[model samples]
Target: MDHVILFEGIPMSKSMRGMCKEEDYAFLGEKGKHHKETDTLGEDWKEEKMERERRRRERAQQEQERIRELEESRKEKEQQWRHHVSELASTQEQRLRDRLARIHHFRDFQRKVLVEEMSLQTDSESSQALDQLLTRI
Candidate 1:
């Protein structure tokens, strides 16, 4: 006898005859076009994708906000530095003007004193010459 055999009503290939039992023969119905039905997961998959996109957008927005805050802080610091520099320059200019005014005043006073001393010396010399001429006569 052969190692594989089929029953009278069961229609199966000779190769699969050894793998199936006599009881499995009753389960096989009429065979026609055997198309496998795939499952639909539209709602579940769509919600998952949307959730991931939302998280990504939130992270990007947070990063942009952090950069904006840093820029604002930098601008504020720069403005403060500019104000400090202008104040310092104005104060230094005022001090320089005060020093120049004092120097001018002192120079004018020295000139007046020198002119008065020269006039006094010339008057004394003329008086001495007249006194010498009278003695000789």
Candidate 2:
């Protein structure tokens, strides 16, 4: 008979029956506007989600870089400490060697003095013995 059928919110039956009025076109345009609004809302939600993910990734990357810098700094400090310790050890070793050499030199000087004193005592004894023997003759 003359029934009106809606196709995507637009009347398609009666062959240009209800669609001939400007009011009908305006009403159908409102339906399309609602669809566009829904599509834009979904797009905005997706964009916001993507932006949040990007910011999170950037923060994670910055944290990783900071950790790497800290590790490198620790390694550098450790290396410097080792170098400083080695230098101190070397200095101490040299000081110990010098002290030992001084002790040895003092001991040698004392031995030489003792040898000279013994020789002087023996020479005096020999001279007194000859004098006694000459007086008796």
Candidate 3:
């Protein structure tokens, strides 16, 4: 680069020497110009393009992973809720059965007491009638 010459204050090609010949160049500092990959300014544009593309692909992959995690979490919560609802239903059913059993027991006890009271009343009325009959005789 330091050995490059200038023609009329315009930057020119390198001098014909060990690395190149005068017939090998078409313009100053240029090979036969049909867009070679090596002649980009500052940095290689292909590498930059590839880097941006890679970043886009990585972001897409990460987004898919996040969606999958959210889906799994939603399913897990739904399953837990279903189990909780089942437990509540079972508990309600048990309570209803117990209440019905208590009502049946109370009805049986009431019927037995009523039967005993009726029997005692019948015996007392018979004794009173017999005493009156004996006194008259």
The top-ranked prediction according to TM-score is: 2
Q: How many residue pairs clash in each candidate?
A: 0, 0, 0
Residue pairs with backbone atoms closer than 3 Å in model 2 (clashes): none
Shift in Å, residue 123, candidate 3: 16
User: How would the candidate models be sorted by lDDT, starting from the highest?
Assistant: 2, 3, 1
lDDT tens per residue, model 2, 29-96: 45655888889999999999999999999999999999999999999999999999999999999999
Error of 3 at 63 (Å): 1.0
Winner on TM-score between 1 and 3 is: 3
Cα-based RMSD of candidate 2: 13.4
lDDT by residue (40-114, candidate 1, tens digit) is 356666788999999999999999999999999999999999999999999999999998999778655654454
TM-score of 3: 0.54
Between candidates 2 and 3, the one scoring higher on lDDT is 2
Whole-model lDDT values for every prediction: 0.64, 0.71, 0.65
TM-score, prediction 2: 0.59
Q: Please, what's the RMSD in Å of model 3? A: 13.2
The local distance difference test score of model 2 is 0.71
TM-scores of all candidate predictions against the true structure:
0.45, 0.59, 0.54
Q: Cα lDDT for residue 60, model 2?
A: 100
* TM-score-based ranking: 2, 3, 1
